[model samples]
Target chain A: MNAPRVIDVRGLRYRYPDGTLALDGVDFHLCAGECVALFGANGSGKTTFALHLNGLLVGEGSVRVCGVPLAASVSAGDLALVRSKVGLVFQDSDDQLFLPTVLEDVAFGPANLGLTPEEAAARAKVALEQTGMAGALHRAPYHLSSGEKRRVALAGVLAMQPEVLVLDEPTTALDPPGQRDLIALLRTLPQAKLLVTHDTSFAAALATRAVFFERGRVAGEGGLPEIVNRFHWSR
Target chain B: MRSAARETWIVERWSRGSSPLHSLDARAKLAALAVYLLAIASTSAWTQAAVAGYAVILSAALAASRLPVPALLARAALILPFSATFALITWLSGDATRALALVEKSFLSGLAVLVVIAATPLTDLARALEAFRVPRSLVLVIQFLYRYLFVVADQAHRMRMAAACRQGIRRNARPRFHAAAGAVGVLFARSWERADGIYRAMAARGFHGTFPALAPTRFRTVDGVFLCGFALAALAVRLML
Candidate 1:
């Protein structure tokens, strides 16, 4: 018997409003409890691909998040379910943490999941504790350091208790210590993860599998070394 | 940009103070404000003795709250120019008493609101409104707008700095004006994109068009008493004067 796939995609394609093809035909899969690094150059459809997982973009293809199919016209009933199953942390933490206080922002996801305020705050508390951000609960996002903001952003999604976590450029604005802290944090999460990033070293440290994207398609995917060498991704 | 952020930060800090007024339930504070405004609007005497009642009420509230008196007055004064404009029109038309009443009422109303706002955090205020049966949609808009206002201001500041860096200090005035115009258009585009991103982030977290409180509000006996006492006092002043 094989481990069931947490995410399965086939022939995924997407185009922007101006008719620019952001993603071409692509196939991807992630098994239960695996961390996969998605590496690609700028504007190579990495973020676009992540957006599709939560039904944010709804491109041409079949995509299943925890076995829930995301259709061309995603129904409202399914959207909430799909989104609940997949927690997406965007590249910009500012985009994710928009509420006035860190605690409010962290509780946002759980509150949306229909948890009462106390329950949501409790969940946020646990998530913040896990991220080592319990002390900064009342601080605003703008007042936080870049690394702290990133952790808070992750805690916001984690509070929702999703089975699959998708992070786009999780280490964009972090220093060395911050990246190290993030890797340590990611190591402890049990959910399957899809990390979209350009940092090869960061990916090499934690990813179980690595995939390289080029020109809106997956150029190669294998062990981190194999994909990195094949694509000559190192600068 | 720094000043804009600092101003908001200062108010938020003030809102967190442990004053008797701050400790009262937001609903009570709002009710008191309503009664106070009603009294001010209904008063026809326009005499210093009549309006002195309002000054006394406000002075007591301000003293009990332990907030900065000068700062509150400064913020309240922001309403003066607009009210003064209307007052000027009335004065020109020879209704000096009505004009004076307008100016006095406006100033008092502004001061009353500033006191309540200073004592209550914006999040609490929104929650109180929700409990008071204000539409959830309107409250949610207020919540997001308050949260994003600083982000938008920061973005605009960065864009301005970027444009300035390229234009340089040696550039002529005309070219700088054109650069600023172009920068404003770019800011609009970025703001629109940022809004879309924020909406997507909200959706990705199981948002279903309604925001629930993290903790429910409780209206206590003290809050009720404060509401009744304040309202009665305002009525007394209105009727006697």
Candidate 2:
């Protein structure tokens, strides 16, 4: 039997305030425990599509996360529920790791979910241990190396206990070893992941399938190698 | 600019150290600070003994914190420039003693704040402020400003370096000034975009309005004793000295 769909987007369309059509008639879905790669050039609406999953950017189209439909006039409570279900790690780790220390940053999401301080800290500790950042819990985020910052950002999202993870350009500022470490780390996570990236090799390593985006629409969807070859995504 | 960031990091490191002053509850320390400031502010300009008393108290607290004394004193001097402007006005108005007192009180107040901040992490201090019923909006603004100041500083530093590389080494002040003005505009725009991105990230993680603390602080017996002792000492100095 096929797995359940964690995210279902049908004809998702979005336009910027300046009249730029970011996402146009895009249809997508992710099954449980599946990792999908979104491949496209810059400004191809990859990040825009990811933003919609958590209701950050409301646009025309239907977005149902974990079978909960995001209505046109979604209430704050509904958005909060959807946000808790979908964790997004932005392209810049600095943008995500705004809290003073690693532990507080990780605990932020859990605490927002109405968890008590002790409960949130416990969840944060587990997430830090999972991300191999337990030792740096008290250290300031700015003092960490680029790799450590990335892990802590991922830990922050993990603490939310989301069913879907949308990571935009996760391997931006890492060396070869950093990229390899991220691939290994991402492989162990159980949530359904959608990675928007330009690195075909990194995508090939973790993505079970790939979708190609062109000018705010899904141009093609297939296996990794096929998508890479069709779009000349490989350097 | 890099030096400023480094200095902030050093202070943050100091806050994390284990010491008697650091162990006190943040709310207690904040109360003590309030008492100390009130004593200093109410002191008469002619009462040099009271000003000296405030300085000694702050120095004792700083020593207890085990932080570098010279470095913190130097940082406290940063307020002199602003205070000096008002002090100069008072001096010109034929109140030299009052002007001296203005500088002295400002410096002592700055040192007292630095002592408290050096002993307690800013996150804990902010939590204490919230516990004291400070408006959530104001507290959030302070938290965000402190958190992002370094990021914005680093961006500005990088922009300066890049502009320097493109402009080359020249003694032309006019062109350099114009370039700097343009860079400021770019920096503002970039910062605005970054702020938007940060808000989006926060919303995605379910941050509605308030920031929640990771660990709730408990006010122990030691904290109560510290608050009472400090407040009594400050009040006695203000009334008697």
Candidate 3:
């Protein structure tokens, strides 16, 4: 259709090494700048589904992001380029933050993108500033509180300036203030966002489109209000 | 936020100086430390007076470099276990003179390592390895290991605390161990998963195994002067003995 889809998935299936069928025949589509929420209870394939979008977990069928296939036919350099376009923020901030300091972690993406040191540092500064983490640049990620670590982790991805942002359980284990801060920040990023979360209230607050996942299949998909109404009716 | 106490401890104990001692090329310092050790080790057994004088001069140089004296001494003291064994062997040989000399030599050699670390930053040490043309992969592994070792340690400490809190019965030895083992397993699994995430993030960012130097260190006049002084002082003490 019009310039292909930003994210296109077809017949995606996956099983863990332990033979757990984490995802089965999940299909999804997102246009530019849409905010979509992936909702499910634990083990409902939400995280597995999100992992597929970025080529982090390979599955049975095709996954094309910005029209490039997620396979070996795509050269390594090109795959990296594709990855740069798709930013994935993991569920735990500790996993995202391995660097000694916030600035170094935030700059990690740009530095790997072949930007000059100066350019990378500037981008990192801007991204941290965006996340309201500028003053904490020199501080270690381990030292930060749970909310601050989350914000810094987001800043690290934000520095790369990816076109699509995929967040897995972005609000788990946060206090009310931390959760509110994350929600407020999510609303302001100018990219198509795929939010994978178990928090129903959080999905209601941020997602325009909702995809309900159950035992690996796409149970249903619709706009937020439509999905909410349908969910209530079915209940 | 790192507590003020931890931050202060790091800056005081971990941060090296920018003085003459700090700037010696890593290779040169490594060589110097080697020669210093050899000299100390080979000295005659009755050289306590000479060794004491050597220690004073070396400690003074450490002080001159602005490294906190008490912290440096405390760290040096921690290494006494390995040194004590060497000293013990020499003493057990039934030569009183040799025993005193061996203890002094071991202590001084340990002090020499402390001097190098106090003088050179860890990054410079990496650069020193690079200077010797160490494989990029090896250097990268070492750099990552150094960077993440502290992180993993901190993560382990927190997990330990959480396990302690949950076990409730402070004295239930069986459940406490069960909790501890489970926590260790979780930490291992979590770190493994985090390693994967870190690799993906690095790949997405374009890390190709080699770490690019953000800032290049330059060898300057101070580097040369420090090496010469250290060598000369060491020589004067050893020869005069």
Candidate 4:
């Protein structure tokens, strides 16, 4: 049985305001229940491409998230719908966890989705439980360790219950044990994931397929071993 | 990094305390603060007594809050240097009473504000302002500023550390100032870029031009009583003094 595609992008291209072409006619997709690791160097357009998933950057592209073709004139309501369906955990947890408390930050997405305060709280609680951050719900984000902050950031996204999870640099500052814990946590989650990272071992652990970005295009794609070997990604 | 972390910690610590003052609704606390500030600002015949009364009220509130008294006073005293400048000028101009009163009122006012802040979280304070019909744009700016103050501070701290590591016992003081000025410009630019990225992340997660209220506020009868009681106390100080 062929699994349905969760994200389908054809002929995607993006350019920065300074006339730098970031993504040059790239194509990408994520199948349901499959985790795909996007391997790329800095300025390779992985992040720029991920930003387009939820209408954050409306670049020139044919992108569809859960069958929603992003419109150029996406309204706030429209973008919100897209965002709720596609949870993108940014590389910097500081950017994601902006609210005063962990629970409030987790509740942010659902609250934006027009959930009542009680419903948002409920969702936040469940997400915190899922990410093992239930105890840190009342704590300030800055007071948290890097690992805790990353988990809380994930909980914030998970609270929205998005079908697609796109995490950028999931293990940047995490210690070995923290990465193990995160990997274990990610294994339990059922959402299709798009992981943008240069961490080969991390990508190999969970990613069913891997894609490499080079010079604004997909340079290679296949099984993790094939992609890593083809791109010479690891030192 | 340590100082920035410590500064944020102090506020976080005070705000977490579950005192009666903390139990008061944010709007009620704000209303009480407004009344107290107004009473202090009024130039009345009994200005001296009002100032004394304000001090008494703030001290009582501080005691109820159960915050560290010395810490609270020190934080309040931070306002003194600026106020002292004006007070010193007033003293030189020959009105010793005015100078004394200026210092007295400013100290009391600072203490009063610190008391309210200790009792309420910054987010709650922003919510209170929103409830009071302040401009939504202004409240949004306040919320963003309060949230990102630490992020920017952390970034600045990291940059400072990098500069220190590169300094290696510098001797050129003039070049040091130039480097410091250059760093300031870079800091602001980086802050702007970070702000832009944060806004995009927010938009991606469906930030629809408003910060979602994590908990809705309901003004209870007790909140009403708290408001009335505090307002009346300030009013009594202004009038019966």
lDDT of 1 at B231: 86
Best by DockQ: 2
Candidate 2 wrongly placed segments (more than 4 Å): A75-78, B1-4, B45-48, B80-103, B169-177, B209-216
Ten-residue region with minimum lDDT total, candidate 2 chain B: B209-218
- Clashing pairs in model 4, backbone N/Cα/C closer than 3 A: none
Chain A vs native chain A, TM-score per candidate:
0.97, 0.98, 0.93, 0.97
Q: What tens-digit string does per-residue lDDT give for candidate 2 at B42-117? A: 7774488887777777777887899888988898898998999999999999999989988988999999999899
What are the runs in model 4 whose C-alpha is more than 4 Å off? A71-80, B1-5, B46-51, B168-174, B213-216
- Please compute and give the TM-score of the first chain of candidate 1 against the native first chain: 0.97
Candidate 1 lDDT over residue span A1-235, tens digit each: 1778989999999999999999999899988888899999999999899999999888888998888899987788888888888989998888888887899899988888778788899999999999999999887687798899999999999998888999998899899999999999999999999889888898888886998889899999899888888888887
Model 4 chain A weakest lDDT span, ten residues long: A71-80
lDDT of 1 by residue, B1-241 (tens): 2377667777777898989999999989998998999888877776776688888888888987999999889878989989999999999999998898899889999999889899998878987888888988898888877887778888888887777677656657887778788888888898899888888888888777766553667889999988898888788878876
Q: Which candidate number has the best lDDT?
A: 2
TM-score of 3: 0.82
Q: Give the TM-score of candidate 1.
A: 0.89
lDDT of 4: 0.86
- For all predicted structures, in order, the TM-scores are 0.89, 0.91, 0.82, 0.92
| Candidate 1 C-alpha error for residue A36, in Å | 1.7
Q: Mind giving the per-residue lDDT tens digits that candidate 2 earns over A1-235?
A: 1999999999999999999999999999999999999999898999999999999888888999998888679988888899999999999998999988888899999999999888998999999999899999888888899999999999999999999999999999999999999999999999999999998899889997999999999999999999888988887
Docking class of 1: medium
